[model samples]
Target: MKKIQLFIFAILLSSTSVFAQSDATKKADKHFAKFQFVDAIEAYNKLIEKGEGNAYIYSRLAEANYNIFSTVESEKWYAKAIEAGASEPEMLFKYSEMLKANGKYEASNVQMDKFASMRPADDRAVMYKANPEYLSKILDKGKKFNVQSLDLNSNMSDFGGTLQDGKLYITSSRNASRKNYGWNEEPFLDIYEYTVAEDGSYQAENLLDGKINTKYHEGIVSFTPDGKTMFFSRESFFENIYEKDSVSNTKYSVLHLFKAKKGSNGFSEVEALPINSQNYSIKNPTISQDGSIIYFASDMPGGFGKFDIYKATLDANGNVGTPVNMGQKVNTEGQEMFPYVSSNNTLYFSSTGHLGLGGMDVFYTKEIDGKLAPIRNVGIPINSNGDDFAFRMNEETGEGFVSSNREGGKGSDDIYAIKKLQPLCDVLIVGTVLDEKTGKPVSGALTTLVDANGNVLASKPANTDGKVEYIVECDTPTELKVTMEGYESNKVAVKGSNEEEVAVTVNLKPIEEIITPEQVVLNPIYFDFDKSNITARAAFELDNLVQVMNKYPDMVIQATSHTDFRGSKQYNQGLSERRAQTTIQYVISKGIDASRISASGRGETEPAVDCKPCTDQEHELNRRSQFFITSGGPKK
Candidate 1:
């Protein structure tokens, strides 16, 4: 009887422990399912401490931490889950991303390799295989902005700042009096305002008008040029609109746009936009400078990715038109969010679909030929291996704001003030090499970029389209040199100013054009005013005549020099005679047979451009030398 009672007690104790573990697991699952990641992380961690953790619990913990951007914690739990053979294909991808976010590139690549093998057709896997060495190039990109953290940030999530009408509007979850949000255990986001001084100092931190700040989430705001109208994103809960899950009896609220009128005291007359639907989310709105259009992000049906950037036209009477997708040029098979339109109508947004430095990166696209151009990454300092979004800028001010969850922030997501160091400092030297006479592409032409000091920066051959492009640093004096066999080389000077792109056309003259039937026509040989000596430029032109003569040993040349209508007739004749002698001597010095070259002087008898009142340019044109092939010609 004693042995029976002891065994029964042991069994009861074991049953009780099992029941407790089940309760803990159930509680953690509930929190995670509700998107209460903070609470779920706590519950899952308790299970691990009690030595009852399984692969499922570990993965949940990893996902929970990842949702809140707890990089170190997420990486740890993901590693553990992966080690225990709990890695799903999606889990492997998440683990790889977490590894990259922590800067463990080698480890991330290993996980990515596994992911690619498992999901060969996934876009992420395809991107990984295509550019396995993208990290170095991303890191080497020049910094375009000097970013600094804002002092107004709280320990909670604070981001999405925009400046309008001398007030800085920011979205924040810093109100301790409000109800906690299950997403990250912080208060629900509200629109806050700060008075911005003329010198860019912030003051009078306070909540926005009660009409705009509701108990539900309110996000980034934009205003019209006249400051009489405002547009922003708000949770649908304010309108009591949500979709209920039949199984869990839970309601999901989607984000929608709202327009408000600015009254005498505060913003009022708020109304939901017509484009709002219970089926999808629409948020991160930015209005055009003229308030005629609004751009945003959404995950609506028929999109190319999880989210895509969209825009809608707005009328003066506050009516919005149908939303149109930005298309594949801007959207991809991943998340694209937080669309911001600059004063100059440039569209900037954050994306995970695009090739970036492992996380959401900001990119900008502008209209070209009435359509959106190919998007380009905004580059580093404004972006990182963390979620970077909510980019707002005033192109006139050269200042902006960006939000990021990168390391060393005071909160989950912190707002940063960005001052433009320089506008992307990359000058694109792009052009086509063409025949001078035919205007057709000169294929196989070698194009080189040279700096002011004549150092070759880059070289490339023209494509079949006769196009050659090189990216050089802005604010540097550069030149584009195009060379091809059987043609005269062409050099175009480019003044590397603030312009981002400079287009040029290199017109190459055929080598046969040099040896005309009558004259070995070189470029104008220039002599300074009242000077008979051959200048360096004049020497260069004279050498071409020598080259033509050398190519044909039997060729003899007659050179004639002329003067502008400036000096006395006798003096002009003397000057022209001396210039003619100098031109002949230059050719002789270049190994040309002195007997093969003869020269004469014409004192302004023949004028290229005849004008009663000659302009400076016309005068310079008349002061030139010409060479005629007196004998044999080039072998053609």
Candidate 2:
């Protein structure tokens, strides 16, 4: 009877151990779901230490690490899972994605093909094959940005450094050699400061002692342009969905923007910004030059991308306006965070969605008339194929700071400063001028420069190398027009305020002219894909052609339209004909002699550029309307 009791007790103990292990796993999974990867990793580590780990647990660990942008660790665990006999398609897909992200395109393609063959009907495989912006191909030609590790010494990770009041205010995850109650053990982050010396090195120090440095994750500190108010992100304790506790008030990550004003006794007590509260995580808050607009990164709903950057306007009464997502162009499927608006109104931020070298790279885009231009990769030195974040630029000098965990770094992550080195005005514009039909460089092409208006500024012929170099004042925006005889003119507009010089390669399409009995003059009109209506620019070109036709009153021409192979053959043929007729009608309406003009539609049958199974852009060569001269007679 005693032996039986001992056996029953052993079974009960085993059951209890299993239940504890399962609970730990559930808690880890909850943290993982909420993107609390650091916490999830710790939990998973504990489970593994208890020998309760399986291939599934390792895979989850790998995924969590990958989510936290820990590529090397993620790859290590992924390989372990594969070795553990995990043959799931998701595992293979994720491994391939990792390989592709790391620039192993051929190997990644092998895995991708295996994944595709295993699941032949999967749409992702087909999409990967047909995707123009292939992740592998783009990363292969990735430009190397210069990211040098600085020699600044701080006890903790120095990140999110901004320049204000002749001092560099930065955020650090360091504790000032004291035990503070606000110190959060779960991935603690905090704010710090440093003074910039003449030697361009930071004399780093902690800020507010332990006052502003919360126990939880706090990062990305920004001060208003006037240097009066300061804002930063704070993670707070709150109930999370994945956790089982009903009244779970334990510290979880939440982004709160705080405000503080400078006072005689250092700074006033930091207060939470009005819009920030117990709900939702917000980080990387940046104020506009005028302090009217506040931009920050958030995981809040209504964003187009994950952890998208949102902008809120502060009214005259200091009331925060509705938060608006920066839109798909600025944001992407990946996180867009750590925004810094330069004094010149250029918006600089970090993004993972755009084609970058790796991880989160710093990008800058100019805001013109409230619309953001395409985000431009800061490129080399400022950005690398690593997790580059928290970019702050000094308006007085074109120098800036970025945080990175790249190779040769002092620690897990370090703050690095980049000096423009090159003079702001010393910018080069280098590109090739190609013949639209042959795809060959055209030398001696006359490229003219103009201001934002149509006023001509400078004219230079393309050199023997088929490149044009123009030096202009970098204070104003400029437009470039490339022209050569017997080809369509090309124009590229570049804003010159912050950018040194604009480099653009122009492709000039051949002007097709038909010499016939009647005098005819017709202009080639370009359209976007699958669209019948003429664009405003195309209309402008057509107007120029109309003026030419009017100058030669007796000249008549035929408007010919064509299409690339995209839609059904019959559909393309009809669409092309309709497009040709539409052009003819538009010309006639412009007071051109109807009897002098004719229209014809020739679909994919006549392709100017024979790119079989071409890309959308290459197919555009077939989708165009041209003018064939029917006759050249005396002026009416």
Candidate 3:
């Protein structure tokens, strides 16, 4: 009797275990079907705790984690599922996508390649592995950001401030002494005109007869590029007709785009846009400068996520076309709304998907050739851990504005202005002018700073120690030319428009001179082997010669060319003549008088560094060219 009772007890325990496992699976399926991924994950975790979770349960948990944007957690579960014998192509593809999104490019490529092979050459997997978003990786570096609240004081929630005709048009929710019809139990926001004084103080006044402010949430406003049309969001609540048994009317809120014609009476009647607003919630209409494209925030179907940004083209008949989703890169699984498209094709929007300080942070993504760049967080003081949204910047001045709920604010939300500190150019060019052979100081070296247009902006001379220091102010790109007698000049072009200071060391090569019986030395012109092309280095050398000629004003030089005895005498002579002509041409190219340089070829007639009866390397030293000052210049 005891044995039979124990067998019955074991059977009952096994039945209970099976029943619990089945119940857990059913609950997980129901939660997943309702798009409650967090709940589904919880159910899957309970099944795993009971030791009833198979490979399918682990795979489902991974999918749930990925759907909720928990990339790290999804990777963890996907690995567990794979170890538990789950090897679907879809699973591999999703794992690869997660890796790619997390910037694990090498691992992602390996998985994607595997998926492509298993799926018999899937184009998407192949293309993704081949041309991964490498540029996005570069953009992700040094992206640390922070947000600090400013001293912008306003009692009401103020935003959408734009600079127009030297004044600021700002919208505020502070309605004083007006009809107190609460807009959805909230104060109605209205546009106000403010004049920014030269001393940086603002005097604001309400515009229009309070007609634009309805008893609903109406903000997120902008004007056309020409300021002739005002575009804004208008909210209206309507009762749903599908619920017949419901006692209380179920009110559904829809955001509609409205335009006001600007004229003598300020703004005319506001009219609803031609686009149908029956199924989708469209708001925050921002038209491009050309009036051709309208960008707005919507929760329409086919979007990558909740409240993704969409773009609609205005046809010739002024009707908007079907809106297109911005894409998965811009729109994440979390809410991506409150778009503010600049005239320069940069889209600024508020997103909660990206790692932010807190709540929705403002981000900007530039569109180049129809491809959206990686979203960039407009760093601190503009965005914080708190909710920051509705970013607007003046196209005329780079001054920016953002609404924040950070600490020390007067209310729940306040509009703050971002003041950009102008970049300063504090670069100093310091170097010693030294004699090339002895390394001794060569004082009185002339230094000149010129812009890209070759116009001299500043000039100074070397000090007693042959050290010159110039405090050149460079707000834009410019060049510097340093020259001294008996030394090759140096010209360096620097990019300093965006940098604070740039320090450079200039090492000038020695100028060649032929020492004659009268204490004269022939100046040699060097050329690259087998090439008569004048490079920038050659040009710099010629510029120094021109400066010396200009100083003398009546100097003439015989440009002579010679060659080593490697080839026939006739061929050597032709080559030598061509080299001499090239030197003369370069001198003339530097704006020097062409008649001043007389070209002549000596072939192998003269050798400064003698190579006769020497090795081939020594013979090569005889190949040379020199410039003889024939008249008007005195040696220092």
Best candidate, lDDT = 1
lDDT of 2 by residue, 1-636 (tens): 000010010011111121223455888766654445578788888888999877767777777666544666777777777777666665676566566457666666677777767766554454455443444434443443334556663544556667788677765555555333221222355566778788766675646654566454456777766787777766544122111234333334455677677777656677777676454656788888888899988777777545788899976545578888888768765568888887777788887656455566777776642445545566655665457788877666766778875656665567887666543332345556888778888898888766654556557788777787765544546666776665656777765554455678788776444223442333447766677776655665676567557666767787788998888889889889988887888889899878988988897788888886798777866777777666774423
Candidate 2, overall lDDT? 0.64
lDDT of 3 by residue, 373-452 (tens): 44556655566545567787654455667776555677546667765444212344455666656777777888777655
The parts of candidate 2 lying over 4 Å away from their true place are 1-55, 79-97, 100-147, 154-156, 176-187, 197-200, 238-251, 315-319, 422-519, 523-636
| TM-score per candidate, chains pooled | 0.68, 0.60, 0.44
Best prediction by TM-score: 1
Estimate, for each residue in 347-403, the C-alpha lDDT of model 1 and write its tens digit: 889887776765688888776435564466788889888888888887887788998
Better of 1 and 2 by TM-score: 1
Local distance difference test values of all predictions, in order: 0.78, 0.64, 0.61
Instruction: Kindly give the number of clashing pairs for every candidate.
Output: 0, 19, 12
Pairing residues by index, what is the TM-score of model 2? 0.60
- Candidate order, TM-score descending: 1, 2, 3
**CA RMSD per model (angstroms):** 17.0, 13.6, 18.9
